[model samples]
Target: MRFIFAFLAMGLLTIASCEDDGGDSVISLNEGAVPNILKVTGSNTFIDLIALESGEETTINFTVDKGQGNIASMDVVLFYKTGTTVYRTVLESNLTTFPKAYSLTQFDIIEAFTELNSAADFQVGDVLSVSADITLTNGSKLNILNNDATPNFGQDIANSAVYKVFQNYIVSCPSDLGGTYDFVSINIGEPGGFVVPGPETGTVTFTDNGGGVYAISDGSFGGWEALYGPPGASGVTLIDICNTLSFGGSDDYGDTYTISNVTTSGSNLSFSWSNTYGEYGSTTLTRTDGTDWPDLTN
Candidate 1:
């Protein structure tokens, strides 16, 4: 009976040893394996995989999983170093698809590596990273990267990247005119000929009310002269006059003019403008209390 019991105990010990060995085998196979080139799919705004090159060429095979739609296009950008700096270049592939299962694509490893090496300022052993930008027929863009297990890169793919190319044009006018001032001068010409000087000058004082509205006053006229409009009431808005006057008319050629390149000192205001009569003109208005006409210097 003791022999029988000893044999049963030995059998139990063998079973336990087998179970322990099996568990250890499974763990070692998983943890010890070297990571190969991998492609995982999640969302549109995914971070592109960054790969470091070890040789002259490193082939990359990618598989798009189920539930992911047909890839309309793929762009591969290579970033590498030369001498002391890094640079980037793009490689594109024609579109291909499968129905529902995974789609596989192979890339030319050496060409990409060589291109990056030539463009980037890097040494031979410098780190190399790989990434991809993908576009679908539905106008969706995706950036595939290695670290993007979580949902990152947001929803808008077009605006996700930092680098872009654009064209910019600037249109500006002279700044000296505080705001907008029309090119105005009294020619004093009669219907038939030039009028002779009588009381050749009068004093004009301009009071800027901020928003491009000004008040004109002479000691006597007080608020009699129009500030902006068709000389109706003494104080008017500049915009009103610009909308109503004709060029070379008594109404002071009402047209919206841009005032730029302003240079002001003390109580003097000087500005230039692209005149409405297809010419450039400048003016200098000085603060004065005199009553002489054309006394702009005062």
Candidate 2:
């Protein structure tokens, strides 16, 4: 009985040793296993990625995950073209700590692109590339090479690890409103108010008066003399917390007027104008400068 029992135990041990779980859940070193990239988060296309200042940083957010095992590491790479071959260098690399989230900021992408080894004389319209490559501890390359994922940004596919060939057009002082403009139209109505003579050509200039108060020059107002210099009730452009340019001025009729609903549409500046006498008007103006932007073109 003891010999039979020993033989059965030996047989059971041999069978157990031969059984393999296929390494489906965890990576097997001898099998040359690879990890699957479950998802990736990154900007695939840089549209209107404006840089207010040359050295100011633009923070980029990213997250990477794997379907099985542990995510070993991640890389945030900024790349540029050098002829037919594109050279890629890692800008950021790190080991995963639990959540596996990554963040990178380009202090000066415009300047960075200019310093590329094989970079050409590319302008604002030229394209560049950025990628976030992930690596698993199993020595597998989990990249955005596959187009089978979702399209995250600009032409990037889902679960893609790459933001390819993006061109950034840096807008210089986009919110500056100092230029000669044409009077598109004006409508003023209030209690017992007459049609004010709206100027056909008007010039608006913005002056930095310190403390977020702008000294405005309105060439269309008839009371050009009394429009300013009254302290709190003077001609001024106050930039509210919302960055809206609000014009406060007085006309020849001693009527306090303010343009509050200001907006810029391409080459036109339009706004809703109102007065203390309950008069309201919609006024639109177009830049007179031969270029689309009078103040910026020069």
Best by TM-score: 2
RMSD of each: 32.3, 24.1
Question: How would you encode candidate 2's per-residue C-alpha lDDT over 22-115 as one tens digit per residue?
Answer: 5433223322322232112333222122442343444434443433334577555555443444444555577455344444444344345445
- Local error of candidate 2 at 138, Å? 84
Report the alpha-carbon TM-score of model 1 versus the true structure: 0.22
* Candidate 1 lDDT tens digits, 1-298: 2234546866875565446443322211112211111232331111112221222222223332212334465554444443445555554444344211222111343345555322122222333344445566666555443232111221122132322111110011111112222222222222223332222233444454321234433211211122211232222222111112111111122223344345555555544433332323344455443322221211
Give the worst 10-residue stretch by lDDT in candidate 2: 163-172
- Give the Cα lDDT of each candidate: 0.31, 0.41
Question: lDDT of candidate 1?
Answer: 0.31
